[model samples]
Target chain A: MFRNIFVLFAASLFCFASCKKTTPLEFQPGDKGELEVEFDNVIGGVNLQLNTGSYTNASGETFKVSLLNYYISNIKLQNADGTTYTVPRDSSYFLIKEENPSQLITLRDIPAGNYTGISFVLGVDSLKSTAPVAERTGALDPAAAGAGMYWSWNSGYIFLKMEGPSDVATSGDKKFRYHIGGFGGFSTPMFNNIKQISLTAPGTSMAEVRKGKAEAPHIHIMADASKVMNGPMNISIATNTTVMVSPFSVNIANNYVSMFSIDHIHND
Target chain B: MINKKKSIRARLGITIAVIVALVSLGVACTKTSRQERKPMPLVLPSNFPAPIYNLSSNPITVEGFELGRKLFYDTKLSRDGTISCGSCHIQGSAFTHHGHDVSHGIEDRLGVRNSPPIMNLAWSQFFFWDGGVFNLDLQPIAPIENPVEMDEHIPNVIEKLKSDAQYPGLFYKAFGEGDITSSKMLMALSQFMLQCVSAESKYDKVVRKEGAVFSAEEQLGFDVFKAKCASCHSSDLFTDNKFHNNGLVPSMVNDSGRYRITLDPKDFYLFKTPSLRNIMKTAPYMHDGRFLNIDAVLDHYDHGVQVNSTLDTSLNKNGVVGIKLTVADRANLKAFLNTLTDDSFIRNPQLAEQ
Candidate 1:
């Protein structure tokens, strides 16, 4: 019985794949352009490089970025005609790690059109993040994803993970690690940690690519690392060093969410 | 006026016909839905509440469940390949460590608390004594990673499984891929655990109107239980699935129970009310397994309740501490609790190692 079911499932999958191949691609009479989303980590206008080993926060606490990674998803580009083109769900969510060679996120297959603004979710939505482990694939798969971002103790994907040694040390361990991500586990609304941010392009018309062409202008997004510890809540390393999923983690998450804004969009 | 009355009668007749048709259609649809889904082998007693487990996420397959059963008995999951899940949870004793007040793990390392029996886990929303782990799929992690328990890291276990010749094939058969994952392993274990339904007791037979009658003493005991214990141990499942401070004082061990998880003073000494399905067979009751048998448990309820701020308000009757029960009442209650023992469940060969 098991063998029969397996055979049928395999056959169905094959049929589905073949059907997709037979189907024609739906493309408008316009060039398919690529949008590059870049992240510039800085500290008070000074460029903040990862693993450089020393940087000070607004609270006079010096720290280093041993690891920094987060999820950016649900990207949408607004056209000049007020119409929006959304990035497909299957390949939308991107895991941005500082150590990765490609700091610039290249979103392909975007139809050539006059775009004004771009908006995206800073973290994976609850619907996908909270889905059963079996359903997830590729980058979203918890086991294959981040080294320390996924909580082994529970069913949750840590949205923002930052770990490094800090000067503020009251205990034996001087390392500061913040794993922030929680949605719908607690009754409080503040515990729902997914953040949504929008950035309006500085230019009136963001891009205009020629027909049958690729590679469009880049959207430069400068994310300041200093704001993470020194935003609305002045998080001191001596007291509040690490948070997994607590009220303090929520405050830290808020700071990280506010750190991103489109510096400028290059159309040239 | 006569024409208007006739028209109204016709409309009523049409409405009744439509309602009948809709009802029949709905029944037919339900029947087909049941057929399509292939009624779960895991028997969900008609009287029990809808299972908390989201079945659609990881539907139980015969091959998968069998694989899980094999893994449950296999000691490869442990550090030295000595202690398996079955080591603590023996089948004849309702899947609990019989005679042991507290559970010991790999290398005879003692754990802090008693190992609770595994039965009807489909209905359990929260797991463990403290109710710290909410998801059932994640519950195994607590035992697997506990230094005193299996003492095996997840990655190490996966590596071991990959090396094993049999496990790779089993994984492929169960999940359609040889790639063994922590998710798949956990889900397969859940599938096996979910099928451990213990509703074939004499009490269930009586409740099901199967011509089985309860003894007079049992009937009386049940009435007493309804009046006193039914609030926390509610319905056929015999659990309200809520945490309560039943006045078990925090010992020198400082086992604060639920408060350790929630970090709230109100939740101090609170523990998830365990289901009393096979309460008679599974001796050494309570989270710490302090009480030896039913008599000690009843005695505690009657007089030994420690008065504290977090004491369950229901147990406090008219400002009097503990429950008021006579010796006769205790005996009768014990008789009724014994009727909950399902002989068929404990002796089931399918659940045991082949």
Candidate 2:
């Protein structure tokens, strides 16, 4: 009886189907991507200028930037191939300031491949501005070391406010403080767009990056802070710096900040 | 022999059919259960636009909504566990701070902006009165992380939620993971907040013709509102979500309402017109909560409007006071605004208490 039962089971098994193929995950893991961004706070491409920024004519006060701080979120490094590596929404970006160069942003877990270029916003878009309280390191620090681009009263970020001082304002010289916000539609505050750059022979692979593929790929951005007051007001307000309280940046003229370059990411 | 073979084959066929049917039924039951376990069984009014917050990226589950409510009431959500969202946004007072113009938070901390009422917010395009914060999902972070409010960091709040055993279970039920994070925290809070729709108000019933009718005073006030304030504060949704410089110039500091956020000169003194669903309950109108009551707000619009270039075009009347109403008309409009107060919404057991 036992032999018969075994024989029957064996015969059934032979009649049954073969093994099913193992499936792969919807999200496949790829090689790692490395990136480096550099920034040059310079004056007319001559001096490696720091501690200088522009002012807005909203208050007509000249405020030479003593500090510059901003955020760059949703970073992406595009490979030469069709495939692109995007910085995850939850992590892999920075809110960097000029004061802290040692703690630059480095994105990992990227779909590592041969990459040519990178792109990122100078400030968080309005959508991300809604939840600006996500905590991380470096740019995520509440202390905001090296970055002076946040408003103390409003608690909102100055996405592209370049302030230092201007000789144009009336009532003697005044401190130019341009607070730029507005990420949500027309009235939101959180937008500063920097140009995008593509790195050449830029290998994101840790091994290739270590083996000297290219100067750690970074985009260079130069914002001339001196041009903050080159235009009309962004909002209605008193011209005197000591006079206006909640003034806003309205227009951009010769005094507006510029991206300068698109491909050369400033790493330092 | 033929009959025997036929019965054997028939039995095998019946067995296979039963097994397949049972298996499929199990899967179907599970799929139905999953559907039932969704966050909320509601959506915004049809007239509204697409929600700024995407639900797919951060899905809402019934568990998530419950957890959010628990967190909302829990004192632990605050820095010192002494103050919670309920401290300022009390259901009894219609979610706005009743006594103070500006909100008082942790350690008797004072917020610069008035603690605006929180209700029917799923339809709101902007969060703050100035429309600074865009999405509803991001609104809690302002209160939770503000130095004068919760005085806590996102990391610290996540840590606190992670340590709490109750929260872990609640979180697992809601999000399928016990490891608490700020995103999860924010998502959960949003689920709870979004479901805070005040559609069951008497005003809503009247609109639906559900045997609800306005009194003579309310009817007169309604007529007045349509005649005078209907341009900016439009039909159905109270506000058209447009901003206006209602001719208010602060004697103290020149605060350029929406202009502060956009840096645009045209939007000065313009604010996100607040929903008047519970306007009667939400006192101290405007961004700074300067006015004491709805009566004062009416008075401002009636006799005190100052004309300027950036003023809301809806209110301008060629140097004439925009939408001037008699003292009687103002009182009647105030009554109509009062009718918008949803007592049931404020007293709903599903939304209130710990």
Candidate 3:
């Protein structure tokens, strides 16, 4: 009789255990680490000093970057052991600008291990890009990011906004604004733009990305602005000066895809 | 007389019961602590279709609607603080600019087209005479940026709203954020516009069998309307929500209408079919407000249709031009159209500036 009660109690406990929600895999206390991701904007392998006029592109059109900002999201760190740790979506995305290069974008609570490579998506994912304005919070929030990056006419974030004055511009103001955003569709050119970049650590078999260490590893990424309009797909500021939203904008977006490159990593 | 085993079983059962109670209590506490907003239901007449605007994304609340109403009336939205949305859309004239054929903006800047009435907008999938904006949340950007209208940038508007003493608190109450945004501001405006439904007309009561009847001439006019006008202006909302040329002539101006958006030659001269519900009050009709009254509008349909490559086939009556109507038919049609004016909607105290 006692055995019967014990078996029933065990069965109830089993049911309770099975019914509990399965928690997502995340960094344990021992595995917690921090990474400082840096974006260095440049022009022709030189530091891009904003508001400094007269930088010539491959097309020979001289221009100055008045404003430059882009979104980076969906970061993943691949370990040497063939396992990958993805940053949580709620806090992974970041909007970087040339003006605030000092504002370090740090990823905390990353799984600590020897990482072979780092991978991330250049633009905001379609799920987030197409989400209604009210759902956006934190870094993705329109108010937080500033309204300049968003096109109030179209319901999508400008994945990349590079505005400046170009000498070749025929317009009265001699200004050129390249606002690129649209996902991949025949009609909707700005919907499915997911540019995945994977880069391996150099000068070592694998970089030791450790947790609870006094010093965290840093990843420096360089974004070349001159390559944006002149990279394999050559765009002229004289003709295609302004691109807001159209199939033409997609051409500019395709060219900028080749702009990001892993510069170097700093080990402490 | 009971065995010791029975007491042990009772205790075990009580312990299990306590655990279950504790688990449920934890869940209840978490749910309450989150303070999930209770959905504010949008009540509509039984006959109306589901709203095109996705209410789930930006749900309406009492505070949001009130904020929108305040913003709609405030001239601070304009660059010069002289023109408000209410300036062009007066509630007395079914929310349309009554005297102006075409709307005038800031600094007495005249717009190219007339301002349409603002009602039954929840059902509409597109907005503006050219159907430029699809989402209601994004519609306000057009007038705000149109150099002739508000002449204000969105960022400038946000900065202005931030500095205002009362707007920050109002925004906090409506959106749970002390910080103001263009999206939140636009969403609040959309909330107020979504509630402007007109359904209490005398014609509506007659249709619902509520002991009301149309006059003999009005009934005749309604029948004539069923045969002649119901194709484009269908449904109780009185709009097909599709673009049509409608044979508006002297098509000299470079207003390519729907063609401007699509860049298709076939879509040229196509304009959105406006709702004829409040036809009597919102006058100087047509996309350009060329017609002064219903008589001029009917006369255009009768004899003034200019044959164009992009003219809608529905208006083509055996290639003879407009819908041929007799003098009596026009009179009866005018009388029937009058019955559609809902005083309850035009004079709704809820929509008035508070």
Candidate 4:
């Protein structure tokens, strides 16, 4: 039954995708309705593979992972119509890897329209963050989103967290963690990071991701692999290779990368 | 004359029709104004009408409630401290500060509000007498951070708990993860609080019509209570959970009850209707702990209500406002109120400090 439902869903999604554009492109198009976004991770030009690692925690010892999945909400693409095609508040947006389809998510019925740029909040909106728990479920349910991100004991979510092998950690062995969330209190902005990008509208006036564009889709996403690490450069050198592995960070707060910003193209 | 009479009749008919239409429109508008209250789940008893604090986001969790209970009693949760929630809210006095009106904490600092007896808490939409704290999980933070209370931050509390010999194991059993977190801690406290269900009381037994009968004195008190107080302090649950000017001198120092929460003048001197289930044990009554016993309380209520507009209507059924009680009647009323003392829930060792 599950497989049948999956197949049916996949077929419908294909129809939804095809109906939006005349031809298929390597990447999705602007406001491609219900497009399955496969987050195939890469560093520079090579694939990024991560694995579980063991280290001591406050509890003495445990095996954790090199990467963890979380949810991001309030997604929007700035369209030339001056409309924001926000991911419907009722729908979901998750950061599940392509390799983990069972765990990954597919956002459906995304409002079809032309969009200049895409933006999203990195964590669940604050109002929903502090809400109560009703049921308990397994590893990959929306119920688990709260389990992964929320801290009931304190009454907020860990809006941003990056923990991994780091030489610059308080301890010599290379695992460091920074959980940034204080609900935007006097000093803490609930979380440490907010990522934004700028881009030109993808279509003429019609709304849809088109076929065979010479350029990549103008979904302005800003990420700096360099911002996450703090250690001797790629100590493992394989999992950490290609991905920047530096000791400090340079995010938009420290530096900015204007995605699809025309200034990078015409001035030269 | 015939034409004038016809015109008058026509005008009357039009006025009634317009009034009917307006009333229907008003009802529709008012009904739609509030957000759609979610339908109660099957777990909600058939007889119960609807829940007040709509559980829209905070869904009920069987596991989370259990987790909250484990954390409630575990002293390993405190930092540099030998205290757990059970240290203060003991079972005997109905989950209140045992033998004391004010709560004592790590290093012996005193908390302000009389440790209100906890019971039938799920029925209540608000916590604390002042009704300042809206959420139950948020309740622990007041004590944990108050310099006189536990005086611990959530992160430190979790850190301390994570290292404790038994806590990580307990946490893993409750939550899948061995890592203890503040959110997890709050969930666990809620579990214990929900478990502290006082549904099997004599009152409950009576209300459920389960062959429980009242003594003559108790019956008389119940009658007087119903006649005078039950309108505001509605039965089934001992309170309507509404704030009222129960009529004490506004405390010289304390916040003006619900007014402190809303800062509205209309709510001045209003306080949450104190649940009377274990009122006999949780003494030093009133928000500021002004009255010492039921005598003082009844006497105060008998003749003590501040004659302000916000004084709840039940107290002034005849529109003759002000606490009204004859001395003999006061004694009878107190005699009746005493029947609400619940012994089983009070003495349940499972809810005690380990």
- Which candidate do you rate higher for lDDT, 1 or 3? 1
Question: How well does each candidate superpose onto the true structure, as a TM-score?
Answer: 0.79, 0.65, 0.79, 0.56
lDDT of candidate 1 over A159-249, digit per residue (tens): 8888888778554677888888876553113366788878777645355433444345678888887777888887788888877766668
Q: What is the TM-score of chain A in candidate 3?
A: 0.82
Q: For candidate 3, what's the RMSD?
A: 12.4
* Residues A1-268, model 3: lDDT tens digits: 9998787777657544643442212222367778887878888768898888468876777889998888888989877668998999888888888888463578888776656577888767778765666667666765346456665544556778898998788778988988876545212132344577787766553444566767777777788888778876788899888987656776777777878766777657
Ranking by lDDT: 1, 3, 2, 4
lDDT of 3 by residue, B1-354 (tens): 376688888999999999999999878755544655445567777667777789888788888888889998888889999988889999888999887888999999988888988898889977888776667777787778777888887678889889999998788777873468878998999988887878888888889777889999999999999999999999888888888887776445768787655545677888889998888989988887888888999999999888888888888868678898999999999999999998998999989998
Indicate the DockQ of the complex predicted as candidate 3: 0.16
Using TM-score as the yardstick, the better of models 2 and 4 is 2
Which residue pairs collide in model 3, if any?
A182-A190, A182-A191, A183-A190, A183-A191, A183-A192, A184-A191, A184-A192
Query: Top lDDT: which candidate number?
Result: 1
User: Can you write out model 4's per-residue Cα lDDT over A121-163, one digit (the tens) per residue?
Assistant: 5545555543443322122122233333444333444444444
Better of 2 and 4 by lDDT: 2
- Estimate, for each residue in A1-268, the C-alpha lDDT of model 2 and write its tens digit: 9998787667545433221221111111243445555555544444323544333334443344554555666677665445566778777446555555542565555553434565666565545443434342345433233134443334445565444444653434444454554343434433333323333432322112222224444444454433444444332123533221233332432234343334243222
Comparison by DockQ, 3 against 4, better one:
3
Docking outcome class, model 1: incorrect
- Candidate 4 lDDT over B83-181, as tens digits, reads 877787777777777556577788777766677766666566677776655467556765665567666666677677777787775665555534566
Each candidate: chain B TM-score: 0.88, 0.84, 0.88, 0.78
Off by over 4 Å in 4: A1-75, A81-83, A88-130, A133-268, B1-67, B316-319
Q: Find the candidate with the highest DockQ and give its number.
A: 3
| Candidates sorted by DockQ, best first | 3, 1, 2, 4
